[model samples]
Target: MLQLPHQSLQVAAVPAQRTAAREDQDGPWHTEAVCRRDEAGLFFAPSKEPTAARLSREDAAKRVCARCPVMVECREHALLQPEPYGVWGGLTAAERRVVLARRRRREMELKKSASAA
Candidate 1:
């Protein structure tokens, strides 16, 4: 079905909007995140959390993020700000570091290829 501009469509009880609220579907949609209703502790790791506890905590947090309405925007915001803590977009900070590293490597490879070409 065709939705008019600026209109949001949800398929279920959860607010899984078909697209972002922005005109281009990429605006600051984090404002509508379901996480806002959850406790802040759910999204952050404890300073002295053990490895096993951290893993379990992160997994639980990821589940919440998976169903979040603004998962994409939250992830983007975390990466752009280089958030030093917490679980965002179903990824712990460490996981996001790995993604960023991979992205950097890919960018370098692309640059090298372009220069060589």
Candidate 2:
């Protein structure tokens, strides 16, 4: 019997904070996130969070994101997944919602204009 060379399929450990797939290039980027090494709680809002506190926490999270090498990638991933909570890629959940809403409105306007033309 001869053993041929083969690639081993090893599963990477998933962190508790991970809420998205990590199979893509985004995985490495996410691993480099400053949030990963810092207090995870800071990236997420507490229950019954006040608007002011949410804003302040989000600002602090964004500051960390500012120095992250993969900030853009992380942000794009968050926007695409439309992550429901936490400060991801420097954006709060509310901000991602706003962006989604704007994109939807833009698409509708474009469709309406195209149909009218």
Candidate 3:
């Protein structure tokens, strides 16, 4: 996996606080799936929200993802499966939907162009 120079620097300079947040296990919901595996299997599950927060603790997740060496792998995984919950690979569910939609549209356009040719 070739990382861009900026990406290497980003990983190297990640804040310690962000790294520790990924290890926190006492959140109302278990977001461990966001980082534990290469696949986005458990990320789509519904879980209890923390009493004090309206949004899930996905901001911390985005931070951890920023430093992930396998961010491309994780994005590809989310794209393949279309995980419907939580943030992954620097994208929220809504963002991933847009990405997948664009990808499909591009593929369709390519196929149409090929057929016309």
The number of the candidate with the highest lDDT is 2
Who is ahead in TM-score, 1 or 2? 1
Model 2: clashing residue pairs? none
List per-prediction Cα lDDT, in the order shown.
Answer: 0.66, 0.68, 0.52
**Per-residue accuracy of model 3 over 1-117 as CA lDDT, tens digit each:** 213223211122211112222223464122343466442322232334343231333444566677666566566666776566556676878889999999999999999999999
Report the error of model 3 at residue 33, Å.
9.8
Poorest 10 consecutive residues by lDDT, candidate 3: 8-17
Q: Per-residue lDDT for 1-117 in model 2, tens only? A: 111124112222323554545556445567777777844566766567677655666677788888888788788778887678787788878888998899999999999999999
On TM-score, the candidate that comes out on top is 1
List model 1 lDDT by residue over 44-99, tens digit each: 65456567666665666788888888788778767777776787777788889998
Candidate 3 has an lDDT of 0.52
Clashing pairs counted in every model: 0, 0, 0
